[model samples]
Target chain A: MTDRWDLSTRLIEPAPDLLVAQPGRIVELAGMAGMGLTRIGYRMLSEASRRSPMAVVDVRGWASPAAAWEAGIDRDNLVIVRCAESSTWGQLVAALCEGVPTVYAEVPSAVRDRDLRRLAALIRARQVRVVLRPLRGELPGGIAHLRIRAVGVVWEGAEVGHGRLTHRRLVLEASGKGAAGMVRQIEVEDAGEDAVHVVSGVVSRASGRAG
Target chain B: MWFPAWSLGRPDAPAEGAVLVVDTKAGVVACSGVDSDVGPGMPRRQAEALCPDATVLIRDIGEEARRFEPVVCQVEELIPRVEVIEPGKLLIPVTGAVKYYGGEPEVVELLQGKMTAAGHDVRLGLADGPFAAEWAARIAEPGTPLVIEDTRRFLSTLDVGTLSGHDDIVSVFRWLGVTTLGSLADLPREAIASRFGAEGLDVHRLAHGQDRVVGPRPIPPELAVEATYEDPLESLDQLAFAAKATAARLMVGLHREGMSPFRVTTELEAADGTVRSRVWRSMSPFSESALADRVWWQARAWVDTGVIPGGVVRIRLDPSDLSGAGRQLGMFEDVMSQVEAERAFARAQAIVGPEAVLQAQPQGGRLPTEQVDWRQWGEPESKPERSTDDPWPGATPSPAPALIPPRPTRFEVEWEGGIPTRVRLGTRWEPVTTWAGPWRLTGRWWRDEESVDRYQIVTSAGAFLCTVGSDGTFLAGIYD
Candidate 1:
């Protein structure tokens, strides 16, 4: 005595988990410079590279490969491209989506709405995940599936002319189709010998998880 | 053949008597009319000190290739197939050309005469393989050809440093007392392979005068892809767009057969019934976008230089020297996905120039910017200038800045009681909430560069990495 609709629902694929980035979606990491946004993007790339190949389209030449290596990214699986011209950004990102499973790109200031739509369609068709970092400006509404903004950052283990910057605590607020109005706080620590990690206990508004 | 002083020998290079040095980001790449003390691979500052009167010029690779095109075209007239190793160096299989021209001497004489008449200094080398021939050309006097009857014997007399491009392996060989090519060749091939892996084996083979030879495979007729235009398009953009699709089709056909081409011949038909064909080569297999890029470069070079009049009718890509598809793929790597990614990267390179598409490799340096070496997408990785294993004192602490500005931007800083209290960003003044360092970094003191004090300052707005120097306080990077 099962419902016919329930039986048919089993045929369709379930929605992807919200904790991690979903395939075929544009995840936007929006924040000003020095607000821990880029570090978060690198962490995502490191995680993505563990499963599949990843790339970074560094539009402003802002990406620090040393920092990315410290963030635990697999260098062999990562490709970093530095692009400056805004005119070619759309075409380049679209081409990247064709091959790479995950792409973290710095968004240029003036991207046409048509290009975003075209990119969104391609993303869905190819099942590629794109993480967009718009430091200069914001993307148009309805383009991004998830948006994570760095609200605050606190540095520890450094004082006037004394200890070096050893650790940071970052608070992020994520809101989108997946986790609407969810806030999370995470701690990033610099372990000695070229290792940086997000140390445990990611306290989410809805549920606490290990990061 | 090798063009002596290739960079300085460019037609647009400075007049003959002037000492010239051509440098790139990696420092001095080529020089001419300078003493041996100021040779290639030396730091520019060091080179400049050695030759005080030398005129330094930045390397313009595109210009070098453009200027070398005529020479390649000239060579093609005498030999149907010629392989260009770089702008200043090329290789030709002399077997067919030598027989047709009666002998190796006749072939060399004809080529030298052709180049000399065209106002170019030329040197030729004849041997069994490219490796021996290149060395022969290097030692050959201008306007003369050097022929080696026994390539192995000739190679045996050379120094171990002749194994260029394998600096790390060569250094190891030098350390092991293998100072000559003869000593390296004497080592068992399997032993070299086991120690240094595939690249070491390659060097050993070269030392033995055995070049890695891949015979050109016969291409299936249906594998060749072509695009025909009804209305004769003349614009470069139109031709490039057409070429992209045609190149993709050729790649698909090759992929279906589990093969990829290391060389391709791009044929273009002009509206005036002129057909131009050029062979483009790559060290690695040509991806779809790479083949397309070569086609674009060829078409643009022809059209802009007026070599091909009224280019419009047809475009064709015929691939050769096909190798197994997964020959370059690493273990556990998904071949299809990796190939697709490379194709996309090459396409991106086409949109932006090749230099813009980069891959980063960690290297030794104190600063974040200097610690990573950025190489072009497909080129073999070069040895790091410095060794990371060496302890770098005064190096920036890790968790390096995420956003490093291409150039540090000047900022206004107000000091209070010998401490930076506030910094002006744009029109707003943000008070420093916390701060660290005045880590004094004196870089390359030998060059008389000023010392700079770097600080990590946190304000209510954000955190910044800034440097205080004689010039001014500048924002160097962001900790984002």
Candidate 2:
């Protein structure tokens, strides 16, 4: 765990004025919790920010784009946490307990022991935003956050509604400005809890409001 | 087409038996047979051509791996010190197994017996080196044995083609005038290795009786139970029962081995002749009952939702992320049930009548009578939070009625504005006891009709109920 007095520099990309000069790179996040958290180690120094607030930027050094994003962490201004293959789960976890946000990102399925404990600590923290990617299969159980993508309908005027409600077919190049590494066309659909239940009319109306 | 034994024929030996090895994209899939004869060639295609009536199965390498699985389990069962060389192969240090079984021949007999009991016919060969034993197995006839002490003389009599044994490698050795194992070993080991790389030296070392021991096979995480049916499983129930039995056996096996599986993977071989696979995970060190339940539930879930189609023949269990003890548990059924239920319910509702169902929901309001309503299932906004903490305004503390009228009642006001002294009940005159101010439940203002104002009231009979003023007072519902 880190002392509150420890100063952390965050790296941000074309971000908030306070975030721009920070020591971390700000990448646009598309999905919810789990998948997003795995990116802290490669993109941001979420692991480093735990022992100390110091970090580095080396996305190009990563073999996998997701790994780069995992390194570009949160909590300490999304600094890149460089870790060797020998890095133990305990180290990343200490950073997570220190309020590191992306510590939960990209947990290997083979994770065990200390890594599992670190995951528990991060989940208990609850303040760290989770990363989300659309599950290729039926959504896995115990997912705290759900993100869905689908191609929506085009209007009579060919004007695609630009809102969380409308999902469109966006052709993402293998290499692009907003590429999520995958070259497939992802239907950018509505995400979050409310979007999932809105059309079902499950939400209760305010007493005074007419239905 | 299934198991055909006719593929084991030799060129000179009449086609009395078969040993078929089919080349796959990555590796080889082999099966042996004694009755049906295969002409000389790769046992697979040649056997198919020879025995048209044979069970011509496209060998599943996975099945071969599964078949080989018991060997590992058997060796580990008897000889505590055995090293695994992939799924179907293993290397024993021999010092221990030979010592324990009294001799290498007895150990070989025990191994052969176990494999035979498991429905396999195995050839036993013992030599100082792993390669020599392997080659001896190829050359040995069924039921005969080879002892490690006589390995030098036995190996010398063997053809040099037995060194690599692979057709391509054997042909090369044969072309170089190498006729016997003794002759191949006579060449300089260094020169042979540099020319043919490490394989040549390995063959030479094996040809001579060199022994370099490796450790015994490490025990699997826990009990891994698998089953292969002689016939395809037709019904989901049978498949589930098989899965449960297999899981139970696997658990017993693990317990006997003094280990526990942290995670369990139960693979269901498709029963309907279709290769459908389903895997289920356990929350804890799953017991037979727990694992069986999961397997049965998963099978039923698949059946109900049509996740897997027609037929299946086998199931495998591979428990990964192994730990001896103190494995962390994640909820299995809670999550599994939700997924299962969603799919099952949707399918059931799809087949039956969606409009036939209804959900009784409590409507929150000041009036105790207006606290509940009914909505058809699948319609929007069916239920809301209705708790006792919030009290209704007009309705008395009396219990509310059950039935609701299709429309509300309209009252003529005797007093100045909205409050009425006299109100007409559903077809008769009645006086209001505990009257609450009217709360309008209005909707679709764009349309002329379908507007409402609900009121809470406690009748003089101490009944707490709600009635709306649309036309005339009709008993809606009573609070219980």
Candidate 3:
């Protein structure tokens, strides 16, 4: 019989290829309200939830569970905390990082610098992946390991009084420590029936940007 | 023992002759001061129709459990280890008590006398096992005690429907012509196991009067968590805080040992050397929050009824009935990490209010908002009111909007030839380049709600899911 019970001989590796941001690091999805930041965030959360339990800190009560389900996140393994106050965002996110492998939180309007440093240290210690969605265009300083900005979007399968929005192509630019300088164009097709496909690849690299 | 009409018999229940009915979302759970036509499990509306003047109140389980604490305390004076099955029902091994009190009749008489003196009407039953004893109690009169000498023979005479908590299995047995416990017990054990699997085997054992023996394993002295206060805790808040910490420590210790306790003893000592303790039982292993809730319930009951003489000085928790940790993780689940996360979530719940921390499960609804059910963290997940299996005709097609505003945001739409040309978004006008129309959504017409036309519009800025109703155009959500 095979030694199935012997865990000491098992090879363990952190899932690096799953997301652009590495474990124990902060990844920011910065954009305006309707610029598809939440869409990208949900996609990342979906991938993260496949590996371990994940949490979402909805500051403005804008995290839609239905959309998240459509985006392929495991509803059973997800916990959504609705917190409107900005002052407690640091403590709440840190608390979530302790239990969940991935903590996807909406950045409040203003975050104190002390909270950022505390969160960064805790993430390193716990090896928890943190994804920050700054929908109102306010970005935290210096702590983010990688920042993916939504530059533009192109809606497909729709025209003047014609078909519905079956799919769309999103343009994302990645920078900071993790990605250096890479631009990726991804196609997010929502073909009804609770199915969504994200075809993504690195399309190009920026010339002057440096980590 | 069983206390009939427990829900309607609370100290704060409505006065007699009021025809009170306690109900939940499902239906009427209990009733009192009413006729047989208004029985439990009947729909609330039908029960109300039967007794027109009845007072209907929602069931408060916590209140029922809290009120039952006094009876539990009364029984504890004679029996050391009383296992409470629910607010109305409890079990205690009578071998030692019977010997101490001289006989079965004497023990029952003593228990009945004590409870009656305390103004509680209870039924006592003495038998070989809990199942038989409970049925005996159910059939016994208020003062009279039911004692069964032969457990198997007594159980054999009862209908198979008497098997509580296994309704589906019992129904199947009834369908298969096994109508009585006698018939079920006569069936081959191996055949029962082959037909019904493990659950059937359990039923077969119960039919033969072989119910599980309530023998709580002796816990290690080191596993007991205790905290002594320098100053006696004067307030309920102080006691609750202490209980939370003590429960957490006990849970951590149990988790480390890869064991969980199904039975726990909560003991509190007063400043005047007065001691009170209660044994709490759970069908599954007790989590940190659950154990803490039990301690709080017991403490509040004692304080509210003036049973505790003075400020409490010490709080201790002793866990028994140890079993392998009941948490069965999935193939890819990391146990240590999951445990750590659960502890962290508990901490987070404390930081924010418990109500603020929520978990979502998919439910049925046409609108995106109604498709998900949100429950507070740590509470058992309830079945959705509507199942997703139903074909909701007017339901929104996937993918759902990423951002649903707490309330719909009104927007001014500029139209050209009945098509939206531009939309006013937060003091700026953005021209809509492409659009999809008017998925007509009708509200529950019986409630007199108006219908609306929902549109999906893609502007230069981003995508918007808006509704155009008689009132005006409102931004329902953003496809961000």
Best by TM-score: 3
Candidate number of the best lDDT: 3
By the DockQ metric, which is better: model 2 or model 3? 3
Q: Rate the local accuracy (lDDT) of all candidates.
A: 0.75, 0.40, 0.76
TM-score of the second chain for every model:
0.81, 0.37, 0.81
How high is each candidate's TM-score? 0.82, 0.29, 0.84
Q: What is residue B160's positional error in candidate 3, in angstroms?
A: 8.7
Candidate 3 TM-score for chain A: 0.80
Model 2 ranges off by over 4 Å:
A1-211, B1-43, B64-75, B84-90, B109-120, B163-172, B211-480
Tell me how each candidate scores on DockQ against the true complex: 0.35, 0.02, 0.38
User: Candidate 2: lDDT of B336?
Assistant: 25
lDDT per residue as tens, model 3, B1-480? 888778787666668664554554446777887877778777777788788878777776667777888788778889878987677788887889988989998998898888788777788888987788998898888888889889899999999998865788999999999999999999999999999976787778888998754445556789989999889887987887788878888877777766678788889888888888888877556878888888877777776676676888889999867853344456787766766777777777877878888887888887777888888887766556679999988776666888887787787899877799899878889988888877899977888878998888997667888889888998878888
Range of the 10 consecutive residues with the lowest summed lDDT in candidate 2 chain B: B1-10
Candidate 2, residue B448: Cα displacement in angstroms equals 77
Docking level of model 3 = acceptable
Candidate 1 shows a clash count of: 0
Residue B29 displacement (Å), model 2: 5.1
